[model samples]
Target: MSKERAQRRAEREREAAVLAAAKAAEAERHERREARRRAVASRLPKKRRGPSGVLADRRRTQTRLLVLAFLVLNVLVWLASGDWAVRILALVLTALVGPLVHILMTKN
Candidate 1:
């Protein structure tokens, strides 16, 4: 009975040692990764945009999404109508939109 108890205790100790070693290795790896990330980040310049700049970026993104939706809808319209006029209109609008958005974004 005593021998069995000693064997069980030794087994538990071995498992505990293995778990501790794994944990230490994981921590070391995490630390190394964090150090590398910090080093890389330090090498890059930070881009700090003000409130209006942020708002403009947001607006630009919204405009792009809107323009994309418009183009898609117009394409569908052209496809459905199977008309040359519809295709030409869609093409003209799509061509003008990006520059128009850029102009509008830049002016404000």
Candidate 2:
């Protein structure tokens, strides 16, 4: 019958419209996710040290500064503190454990 064919055509049109809307929504969501990823990536700090050589250089520079600051602080402490026990303790610690703890404690 003509009415039956019309009903089937209408049903197919509705299904096609639903499928098209779903596809459009999925594409929009994908685009939104990509834009968000780009936004987050833009906020990150740029890595300056590419390859192994630059990284080694950075480590060496930091280590050298740490050692220099430690030595300077130790000399100042040795000159300032008058208590014999404290001075003796400093000397003993310097001889036994080296400058790392002394440097860390000097901040407090």
Candidate 3:
């Protein structure tokens, strides 16, 4: 009976040691991951001024191009179709909706 109790106690101690080691290892891994995340976050730019300005300029240029295209298409539709009602509707639709479409599709 004494020997059996000692063997059980030894087994229990071994399991506890293994659980403690695993917990310590998991904590170390978490600390390392957090350190790496902080390092990467620090390296990235916090504020973007130059790129945003350039992008805005490009968007303005693209918007102007879309407006031009919409105008040319409207004129073409009028000239080719030669129907007053169709031309009026097309012009109104293009003038009203073209800018909105341009803005929606624009990417920064």
Q: Pick the candidate with the highest lDDT.
A: 3
Cα TM-score per model? 0.49, 0.44, 0.47
lDDT (0-100) at residue 8 of candidate 1? 100
lDDT of 2 at 51: 47
Candidate 2 segments whose C-alpha is farther than 4 A from its true place: 47-49, 52-108
Q: Positional deviation of 82 in candidate 2, in angstroms?
A: 24
Give per-candidate clash totals: 0, 0, 0
Evaluate model 1: give its TM-score: 0.49
In model 1, the worst 10-residue window by lDDT is: 99-108
Q: Candidate 2's error at 56, in angstroms?
A: 10
RMSD of candidates 1 onward, in order: 6.3, 10.4, 11.1
Q: Tell me model 3's lDDT, rounded to 2 decimals.
A: 0.89
Candidate 3 residue-wise lDDT, 25-70, digit = tens? 9999999999999999999979765545877788878878898899
The sequence of per-residue lDDT tens digits that candidate 1 reaches over residues 1-108 is 999999999999999999999999999999999999999999999989745887778877877886777778787978788788888887787678867866665565
* Alpha carbon lDDT of each predicted model: 0.83, 0.77, 0.89
Candidate 3 stretches greater than 4 Å from native: 1-52
